[model samples]
Target: MHLQKDTNPALNTVTAYGDDYIEINKTRHQRSIYFTPEGQIYDLGIQSPFDFTTELLQKITGVCAAAKSPMDFLDHAAPRFENPEQIEVLLIGTGKTQQLLPPELLHELLNARVGVEVMDSQAAARTYNILMSEGRRVVAALII
Candidate 1:
């Protein structure tokens, strides 16, 4: 029932994630969430995560849809430099199951220089919070 508030203020932290929502700074969000570096939390229409660059977040929007295979979502994280290194890693939460990443999608991200990790939403939420606390350039596309 308590969120240990950190003295230093950063982007809101993921306190918890439930069946269909994510908690940030102790505020329980019961719907899909779209959070940018900016303070406000908007409805992503599917809810997703972090001081994350909006550019990166926007890029993720390009591939964040509910699909049986991640291939359904496209890779848009490639930067103009055309370096796949634009994003170091992307964490994907595939609902309640640990599904395989689409080959095409995985290939695109690898070619574009991004690493991908697939897990369930709960695990992803925990991982995301850990990475964010470490100040890594990480993002998550979550489904609850």
Candidate 2:
């Protein structure tokens, strides 16, 4: 058997998390956040799942959508991705509990071919780390 090592030492990983905060790469964030496996992190400023609105979701879709893919995340210009293969699914961490979002809210993402996974913040964090380690194109929006 062969083992492949992650070449990027700076890749962000969820280190610790609690009901009120999440630690990524050893830094703590009390607010919600969005992160990619490549170490790109952004504060989402969402205090709860209710703060994760359709507009915010649209922005996320813009960030993750492939340049050549359908413009399904609103009418804004889609962000170009260096590696289209790096984006697969989006993990939504619904704060302290798992919350189901309306299917219509995710319709655009689905049309763009991006899968959605919704879970509690803690579970989402763990899943994000695992998917990232495996070099899957994954993004996480964790509500802390």
Candidate 3:
């Protein structure tokens, strides 16, 4: 699907998506990723939503290895924010299907007051554009 440009072109918007990848701001990402509307995109190397764990968050928090840069696979991307508290909402797109994350995996986010919504990648992409265009502090973690 191809999404029309929003009023806020500077923000990362899902221009198009498919069963295996999502295009953000005309850039194609084939791996799992999390991004804020303000243009922070973090590549989560896990192949499936089932592979998501607190360790991934740990990596972003500087407790583990660095995450891969979506822009350049050979380069490493440093963590921009310290924690999930930076965003008000978290959209978790569980690949081609909608799968609810186990509560244990979300305990950290809930404790940080981040509201999470689980859905399929397509729905997450649509919802992300709407929330982002509205200027809300939203982060989307999509497993492609």
Candidate 4:
């Protein structure tokens, strides 16, 4: 809500977003940072949001050229959890433009038992924060 640090430093929060930089937890980073409700933050490389995970954040590819479609990217990284089906929704931040997802992409997510929403990076960040604050099972794949 506020462009400031979290009341509790133990949690990771997005402080502000600039043209090509994002300030998270009071630290300005030009690179993307993957964070979870659990408050752990990791530097996300140039790879798409698919490569970042709550437990392990790794850059599997340089720029994800193999992903001809968004669905390919979405299915690229499936998190390791007790039950992957527990994740209710996935928020995808598509850089500066609002992305219109294809039916196949939606079908893929539905098949995975997860809902999907696509928005601009800023909205994605805000929504991800708010939903995460509410203790929802959410993951943000932000294209910063």
What C-alpha lDDT values do all the predictions have? 0.57, 0.76, 0.75, 0.59
Question: What would the per-residue lDDT of candidate 4 be over residues 1-144, giving only the tens digit for each residue?
Answer: 346554457666777886577666777767665556554566556445444343331121111112255465577864322333266667767676776555543444454456677788788888877886787877666667
Tell me each candidate's TM-score: 0.62, 0.76, 0.76, 0.62
Give residue 31's error in model 2 in angstroms.
1.0
| Model 3: CA > 4 A from native | 6-9, 57-85
Off by over 4 Å in 1: 1-8, 34-58, 61-85
lDDT by residue (21-127, candidate 2, tens digit) is: 88877677888899887756898877777666656876765634445656555667645433244367889999888998888777667766778999998999989
Could you give me the TM-score of model 2 versus the true structure?
0.76
User: Which structure is stronger by TM-score: 3 or 4?
Assistant: 3
Candidate 4's error at 136, in angstroms? 1.0
What does candidate 3's lDDT look like per residue over 1-144, in tens digits?
778754356778888999889988888898888887765678877777788887664443332223445775455643332343357777888889998878887666665566779999889999999898888888888888
Better of 1 and 2 by lDDT: 2
Summed backbone clashes in each candidate are: 3, 1, 0, 0
Residue by residue across 87-127, what tens digits does model 1's lDDT show? 55677776666765545546545555566787876787777
Query: What is candidate 3's CA lDDT for residue 93?
Result: 88
